[model samples]
Target chain A: MSETPLLAVHDLVKHFPLGGGVLSKARAWVRAVDGVSFNVKRGESFGLVGESGCGKTTLGRLILQLIDPTGGSLEFEGQDYTKLSRADMRFMRQRMQIIFQDPYSSLDPRMKVDSIITEPLRATRRVSRAKRREVAVELLERVGLQAVDLDKYPHEFSGGQRQRIGIARALCVRPELIVADEPVSALDVSIQAQIINMMEDLKEDFNLSYIFISHDLSVVEHICDRIAVMYLGAIFELAPTESFSVAPRHPYTRSLLMAVPQPDPHARAKPLSLEGDVPSPIDPPPGCTFHPRCQHTFERCRKERPALVEVTPNHYVACWLHQKGGGKGEPLCE
Target chain B: MEKLLEIDNLSVQFHTPEGVARAVDGVGFDLHRGEILGLVGESGCGKTVTALSILRLISSPPGRIRADRILFEGRNLLDLDAEDLRQIRGQEISMIFQEPLTSLNPVLPIGRQVAEPLMVHRGVTKREAYEEAALWLDHVKIPAARERLNDYPHQLSGGMRQRVMIAMAVVCRPKLLIADEPTTALDVTIQSQILYLILKLKEELGMSVLLITHNLGVVAQMASRVAIMYAGEVVEEAGVMDIFDRPFHPYTQGLLKAMPRLGDRVGRRAGRLNGIAGTVPPLTKVMPGCKFADRCPHMFTLCKEKPPGLFALSDGQHARCWLKDYPERRKAHV
Candidate 1:
């Protein structure tokens, strides 16, 4: 809605060094987030979806600056966050928060709900101790938890309730952008809906944006306005939610959509003809990272890398099939 | 079709420091020969407990399992001695767990693990068992199965490890297979592959399967019939199509509506997702009424007064709801 996006990441790259010791030097780098670019508009829910080793989680961490990026620019609210000082970054973090996937490990088991919720406020010293407690109670209520639950420990609560605490903690800072990294994946189906609905309500109430990272397409489709389909480390496709679901251009996206098992038993189970598992990110295949498993592979696809190009108004795809003269033969999808 | 397994009035309780938790409360189901019966429910819904109870896997002192009958192929498994149960477990009935890594032996070679069941049950030589194991691994679509056989559990990827687990489970050619969230830990693509593999194996081997999962989509795809569980009770049981097309129980309806479908993104923008209002009731507390009453959207006075029995809807369809008794009231509410 606004001219400047809430969060803008340009060519972000994070490479984890593999096999570093006295005997062996860093042999190689696992390109966790290699040259990824995206922008999250204010009040928008942007989804990052991929398989296990696609580095979607790593990308989320990189955005939050939980881990340092190997290279790229991170601008939040038009300010270059990568260039910000330590104190400035810490202050900036108040505007950006994260909700983890696993509620069991995310929350401090020993700490009370009130202390956990108010930890962010305590770190910044932005409010009085009494005020912080009040904030925690209010935040707890906001997340559909009772004030009485403040005294209870993490172990006392269920998975869904613990996730609510995590949400309450994230909202304690009143962040403009929240990186929810597979927030509902660990939750049961029924509980997952509750959390997703709660998140939607909270987003509306706080006018917050989210970088929703998940492998579940259905959840991503429900919560996200726009989605980016990530591969080994790079985004293969980016499109609006409706367009992506209705007419996905990339073979990977199409395959993913087909792969999701529908809740209707009458619906036919389409055989997923996608060959082999996701290739190792450490030793990624040449050309398109998805080419090895992709059904529409050609001579050109095996030889050159494809750049992300806008095929339609808002739909972007990185595939040789879309580019003119890129495919050796006839393109698979029109 | 012949009934391969029949569970009648099965109950499992765990005595913890807090209280006696009724993990599985009078749950019953029938698995016909060569048919896949999906036990569908969320976490703590006792789906896994029901699966474990079938094999007498629940540890005693803390856990106590009671059943009128647990007839597997005309033999009451509950009446079987330790030695008889041991003989039946891997040979007649086998189970594959959610986490393949932990379920598998970390130190032992994958080949040995897969072959162990055959060697123990069939009294086959180690060399013959290993050869058969390689064939089963190849059947599950594990590439270069012979070479991967020597690798430890840690050596293979998550998807590969799950494939190995599947191979081991099917190597014995058991009469019944209990897959408790077999593909839960794998990615969507790999999950599709595994599900198809299981389907193929079921067809080829003609073995009855009790598929336990929290995912409704998986049930729709894999099972011929479905049993929807809530608070340790099977609230609804019907043919897969019947359950999906016209879910009778409020809990079943809630679970269905709660799922985020790919094409159902319209309501996401204009309206909030249709999620169940409250969290699952704690198993420690014993209530006289329906377990789902606390979270049921259509709760009436009768729902709290007494627990409902299974009301037969059709030949095979059944739902536990008071609304079925008072048809006029149910119609009026609708």
Candidate 2:
């Protein structure tokens, strides 16, 4: 991997205004993704994990240019994606694709597997039917779907199979990068492994970079090279898979790690359940978004929002409790 | 050590347009008092159906509890009338659903939603029920229960709504709780909080819980005993440690291997996900052979010919597989 990032997100912010009326011209804004920054290297998998409604999906969409961010800059392959025209963006989208969470709803019910896979090709340009069919077949085979399955619709196949078709469609344009938003979360556990394995193989085969967005820590740990743990609207921790899983630095990240039910029976219980509900995004609390629920929260935490500072070589954490004031807090960071 | 509930030959079938789908086929299990019995399975494996059956909540038009006996506290739940079933539902066997929003009445206030069961089942006055609702709400750690009491379901976050649901379910002081994928919808951080709250509530009330989830890790953490279901039948049943440590069934082994755990990543080849081949068979397609035979690597002619019944492996371990029946002839060992 090179020093230059393949995809860079800087100060990304997406806010949705809620409950506006004529009388009240402006209502409060729900900070879906607020002041988030991250970068994905070429051929690398960067995971974005958060609870539902934490704006992980919104962030992914922002990166893919599906949803326009209220603020921020997205540079993909060193190109300013946010500045691209509609037509230019359409062409640029050929190099980027997305796989949604629900396979059943994501795919068209009326369209056959072949058409669904080749839709990207069809939209891009006028190609010969035979040539399109050939490309579609190649993609289907690449995703482990048989040629005989071309005639069947999405509803005919199982959840995992449909997801494979979705993958095939994403691969139709030969995208260099793919954004998978909870792709395997809807599938069965046994089937989730198959999808993850297939993604890893495809990444190697196509030399693709993946922005894998999911809530499952175990799944993320299995396949992701680097993971970013998002809370409310901001990233609390970002580290390599092993580091994030073994010795998470952020209090929220640590709590998340301990929360994952380990198969080992002898593993001591250190469950640090965060104290309260995720504060409302519409009217979020001042300072650290996690401080209200954090166990290690102190006076500094409630008043000051910590910046994402590197605690180790690559591990980044945003928590006042981990700040270098050397307050009476126990140092869990190694 | 007292048995709170025992289900015997509980076969639940759903009459769909496709066919009469056997959701739960002759399922039997015992829920001892103050124990957490984890019912583990993939989607469409009837784990949720079994839980719904226990509460007599299966929708009759499509669902039929055929050829089974559900005994709760020595009383046959199957024999109970509509009124009696309704009375027993939240009072003795409350269910916490997978999606709190869908389960909760969106139009009603959080307090009203929580207090409805108390008012309906226990015949508490409006004021008394509201008081109980606020108390239980506080018990579940929903901060500012008084202020949030009048808030609608949509006002609360996923975790908060789930807590509200839990509060409502336990407000009746139910002897048994059926949590159907309660934490699956939430993130790991929030999920831990919910798990912690449930465990605390269970201890305080001395309630036995039937936890339905596909995540084996969760089962290992919470369950004293586990029943591994596949295609509407419990293929393996044993202590949590026994199942995780020495799984007797091929399907159970497959599930364990398929999970890409943090621990399993070490010393393992990259891009190697242990996924079982072939998808789960549709429940409508009844077969004489083992339901998992098509996906089983060690499947033989005998396995494809006849469905293996539960064979006792040890004092408390049982497995339904032909390989278990003939240990000497076992091939393709996990």
Candidate 3:
């Protein structure tokens, strides 16, 4: 394989205009994905994690071009494909697919398992009906389902089985990149484990890249090679899972990690020192979006927006505290 | 510790179109005053159904609840009439749900919603209720509580709406709080804040909390004792440490192993996650043996023939598994 990343998103932005009259311009803009940048290498599972309305979903949708981006670019195989024509974009979409959070709604109630799984195949290319069924059965078995399930409706299956079918549908087109948005969030813990492990194995089997989007920290850390923490439609910290979960540098990341109820009863989380909900995206706090909720915020944090800078090897954070001559976060070596 | 609420042989059945769904079957647990007992299970495992049964929240005709005894402060709640139960509902015990938005009245301002319990239970004047509501909201860490009191449910963010829910649940100073996945809908950071608030209020007010959730992390942090339910039965009951470190039930062990822990990042790939092989059996079907037998790795002749009663392992720990009958025999496999 070449050195080029399978998917590279640079300074991506998506702003939803709101509350405008028929003739008037948009009164306000919801900054859903603001200047986001990341790369998913071939056969890599890159995780994008954030709370609700933090724009993680928007960012994922933007990557698949499921929605139009306000600015920035999506590069596939070192090629800027955003400038491609409609017909060309359809061809590009064949290489990328998305697995949604809601399996119950994502799958059509009227459609049988065969039609649901083979929908992508039918849409993307002209395949024989018998061949589609063959491919569907193969994918179903691969995803831990049986041939009999191909005739059943979604309601007949359990949540876990439905999720497996969802995975099968996502892989039916033989996509190089799969954008899995909270793929396991809707399922049970036991089922979540099964889906995550299967996804990991499938990544190796298909040699595919995944932009795994979820609000779940432990799952993200477990499954992804690289993790990016998003807050208020911006990346606060990005690093490998080993360093990210164990030793988070960014205050937002640390706070998020602290919030997770550790499985061990011996360790109890300290009371949250921070205050207030995330600021309105329509009119976000000036300078740093996180300054209002960060305990370590200073005058500079309120006046100057920090850029993503490397704090350690493979560890990057967009926080003033990590900047030179900034407030205490970590002691720098001479 | 004195028992605040004691449930004995609780069972709930929903008369669905298909058949009788035994949602909660012969389940029992105890919650002492000034303590949190986490009732945990995946979706459809009857943890939520068990909790709802405590308050007689199940509707008639379609739903029916039967219990040998649901004693609260030495009184049998099962015997209480609608009028009598109404008096005890918010004054002695209150419950919070997963989705605060759906639970809260969308048209009503948050202040009124939070203050309603105080007015209904305590017979306090509207003025006094509003005043107390504002204070409680502030206590839950909602910024500018007085200003937010006028905001409708739609106007407030998810975290803020949950704060409103908490304020309402605790404003009456109920001796027992049935928190049904209270923070499940909020972000991780907001979840921590809510948990901290619950702990602090539980400390100050000396309240017993029956915390129901699927997340083990939440149980670890909040619950002193835990009851693991599967397929409408309590598979395991133990202290938090016992559940995590010395679990005896195969189902419990499988769940813990299935979970992707924050500390499991290293050497994760070396071992595949041990997810339970099958989905929880449908409630409509009547299984003669142990409900978890189908998925149990250590299923024996006895487990498939007859259900195992709660086998006492230690003073407070028990497991509903046939292997518990012969600990020595079970030890041989491990």
Q: What does chain B score (TM) in every candidate? A: 0.97, 0.96, 0.97
User: How do the residues A178-249 of candidate 2 rate in per-residue lDDT, one tens digit apiece?
Assistant: 999999999887899899999999998998999999888778878888999998899999998767766788
| Fnat across every predicted model, in order | 0.76, 0.66, 0.83
lDDT of 3 by residue, B146-258 (tens): 98889999988888888888889889889999999999888888888888888999999999999999989999999999999998999999999999999999999989999
Span of ten consecutive residues with least summed lDDT in model 2 chain B: B262-271
Model 2 spans with C-alpha error above 4 angstroms: A1-3, A19-25, A268-270, A321-332, B263-271, B332-334
Report how closely model 1 matches the true complex, as a DockQ value.
0.70
Off by over 4 Å in 1: A21-24, A329-333, B266-270, B331-334
DockQ of 3: 0.74
Please tell me which predicted candidate would have the highest DockQ against the true structure: 3
The TM-score obtained for chain B of candidate 2 when compared with the true chain B: 0.96
Q: In angstroms, how far off is B334's CA in candidate 3?
A: 7.1
Model 1, span B183-272: residue lDDT tens? 999888988988998898989998989999988899999899999999899999999999999889988988888888878875345345
Residue pairs clashing in model 1 are none
Tell me the whole-model lDDT of each prediction, alpha carbons only: 0.90, 0.87, 0.88
Q: After superposition, how far is residue B169 of candidate 3 from its true place, in Å?
A: 1.7
The digit string of per-residue lDDT tens for model 3 on A1-334 reads 3598888889999999997888989988999988998778888889899988999999988888888999999999999988888878888888999999998998999999999999988987999999999999999999999999999999998878898899899899899999999999998889888898899899989988899999998889888899999998999999988878667888888888777888889987677776778888989898889998888778988987888888889888898888776655554322
- Candidate 3 chain A vs. true chain A: TM-score? 0.96
